[model samples]
Target: MRRRVPNEVGIAAVVVLVAIVLSVLSPNFRTIENAQVLLLNGAVIAFLALGQTFVLLTGGIDLSTGSNIALTGMIAALATSAGLPWYVAVIAAIAIGLVVGSLNGSLIAYLKLPPFIVTFATFGVAASIPLILTGASSVNVRDPFFAIIGRGALFGIPMPVVLVAVAAIVFSVVLRFTSTGVHIYAVGGNAETSRLAGVRSARVIVLAYALSGLCAAMGGLIVTSRLMVGYPSAGSGNELFYSIAAAVVGGVSLFGGIGSIGGALLGAMLIATVSNGMNVIGVESYWQPLVIGVIILVGVVLDTHRRRISLATLLSRFRGPREAAAAAPTS
Candidate 1:
């Protein structure tokens, strides 16, 4: 059973190894303060990655996630400034996320548009929102109560990390134990076959993108809360990491319908660890982008390998069944 380690294992192992290496290289890396910082930084990315997993499982992508985050975050901040109740402002953020996500879903599923084009288009829309809302200025959320939601600690555990843990657990349970999860995988694996087999492939695709939107919103909230402000460009460039790294590293099939929640978390942690470690090590800030690019490329190669293996395995299963039929005695 343990002979062939799963591809997820590679991601998990690498995440752990990177954390350890970072710890060793920097004295501050092992401190409790650093743990909190890393966790806070990690939470939003993980949340977005969770959303990306859904779209990816359907053989789709959400380039708009980062922009969605910025837009949502900005809205939440603006609402708070307008004297809305803190909880109400938060709800507004989520509602915006749902609306944007559902829009992407509608276009892809109902209109039969390519997921790529639909999401890519929304990406521009999402990105533009912050600019319009901010008028090119960042919005700061300073209400003590609202600020607590973003930066406050509870019993020594950072709230952001807790939020991430909850999101992951819920997402994992839904994906592994619900019909909707199966629908997502089916649609991604083979839309025509799944549709013919009575699965609602189009609905699944729509739902996947909607889920992606929700995840991006949650991530945006995390960013807004942590920074106590929403920058016009908050979460910019994050989709580059979220879409490819989370899906690829988490064992989510690039072609659709395969993934594990734990793997996605591992992937997020790995990226966070690297970025944080590099910051602590005094590496030139400009060089981080190059390192990230290389890492993403490696993940893409691994994803391709996973797809090939899945295809080969399915073929073998088909061949085995045929061989059994051929060996049966004629009646």
Candidate 2:
């Protein structure tokens, strides 16, 4: 009987390979400053990736992350502009995220709607938030406190990067050591089985989306702080890439019940590397999307192969069990 493929190992190898290739392609890609920039650029998406890890763990996807980023960023900026304390503005932004997440969860959990459709509808509304709030204008956040909160670094690390690291640590602890994490994986792995085992499938499902919303909110805030301005189209169409990259790269099974936060971070970093390398090599902006699409396709293919290899191994292992039973333990 064959053994299950080591998906994590395979993915890590790919990440390493990509990094090496990019380093070879662009001499500066291996430098510390560029490395920081890559991570800085990916901070928001990394936040999205981390949050998406939760949702995906429960066998779900979130399309509204980009939109949520837009909404929260603008809202926070406006709050800061209104003389709100920096901390207060941050809290308000988180509240907005909670509301948006709760709304998404409530509809799906209580109302029994499909997550994709619900998120899609919310995605549309969220995509319009900056426009609704600012009439398609950019809102600048000039509060020194606010700016420092996002742009400032501690011990030479970017604020957003530090936050992402913290979030990853927390999520890793939660997903690896908590009962809620088990329930989440169970619900995603098999809803019927999870319910039969007394897990609150509904709550888990809803909570997953809520967490996803918060992630997007965090991402938005980071981007806003970095840019110091909120654009209506700030996060337009970013959800697709963020979701796919994290899940595929992190070994978070699209089939659910399997993945690690560390893997998700690596996934985000890999995508960030690609974007950073392309820029360093002076690839035209227009071709960036094309490259992203191809990379995504490669991820998908890896996922496909991982699944096939795993299933084949499993089947091979089981084939002997049936054969043994049929042959009987006559010895």
Candidate 3:
């Protein structure tokens, strides 16, 4: 039997408490307009976190997510500006993501390069690609279909939020019921064991990075659509940290093989809530990063503690009756 951790519940509690506190402290925080802003902005982080979840589950990290977004956004924008159809531009963006992901995966999985080093190198290349392609300029997106994807609402709910929810549902189902998903967990849990069990760790790792890239590209498209422009430095490095933090905070293990897409969604929402609450309560913009950092520190500590407890519980459950009895206190 697998041992359970309380990280998910803890995160949910924190989110509820923060939302209640923010609502009490600032009337504006409870308004529909503010809610819309929070969800719409949060959708991008949620998408990025979902991708990060996949990589982290495979015992790896992708530092190039922000760069992937920049490059892919520029690709989409440039394609559209060149008289290509909007769908073609969208496909171009995803293709860029897949190609970049493949590069990261191939080097790490096949070449036996360290994930951090490979992704870090790719991060520089991917980030600079947009600058080189556009000479560091922004491109406006004017296609009505593409524009609506970013700005439209369904039944009064923002499209980005809806899209994110749909994606989350699909991913959750895939991770829970599919053979590939099982392979992902197996690979992350124990690569040697998984290989002995006939799982192809290299292919799975590559696919995970590819999915990460695809998600990054989607996030980039949403951001571009919102602003209606593809800025060379659109995502910046901040998003990379946010996506990782969200995955970690939402119960995704940094050590790998233990997380859910639903948890990642909650983590993303918590991040968005914190940022929104701080703004509504009049915190200085510059101080927001400090607040986020503190939250991440607390989350990491809690996760470590949870893992320890889970380990202890599992060990106790496996001990023989006499051994367990001998170890127990006799008050």
lDDT (tens digit, per residue) of candidate 2 on 1-331: 9996755676678778988988888889899988878878888778888888888788777778878888988888898888887777788888888788889888888898888899889989988877987889998885767876568999988888889889989888988899998999898878899999999988888788888888888877887888888767877854557656766676776767778888888888777777778889888867877877776677767767877887899998999889989899676
Scanning candidate 2 in windows of ten residues, the lowest lDDT window is 237-246
Model 1 error, position 234 (Å): 1.0
Instruction: Name model 3 segments beyond 4 Å from true.
Output: 1-7, 321-331
- How many clashes show up in model 3? 0
Evaluation by lDDT, superior candidate among 1 and 2: 1
Measured by lDDT, the strongest candidate is 3
Q: By TM-score, how accurate is candidate 3?
A: 0.93
TM-score of each: 0.92, 0.92, 0.93
- Of the two candidates 2 and 3, the one with more favorable lDDT, higher being better, is 3
**C-alpha local distance difference test of each model:** 0.82, 0.81, 0.89
For candidate 3, what is the lDDT? 0.89
Q: Supply the global lDDT for candidate 1.
A: 0.82
- lDDT string, candidate 3, 1-331, tens digits: 9975655787899899989999999999999999988998899899999999999999999999998888888888888889898889889999999999989999999999999999999999999989998888899876767876679889988888888989899888889999999999988888999999999999999999999998999998898878778989988846887898899999888777889998899999999998888888999888877877886787678778877988898887788676978999999
Sliding window of 10 residues with minimal summed lDDT for model 1 = 238-247
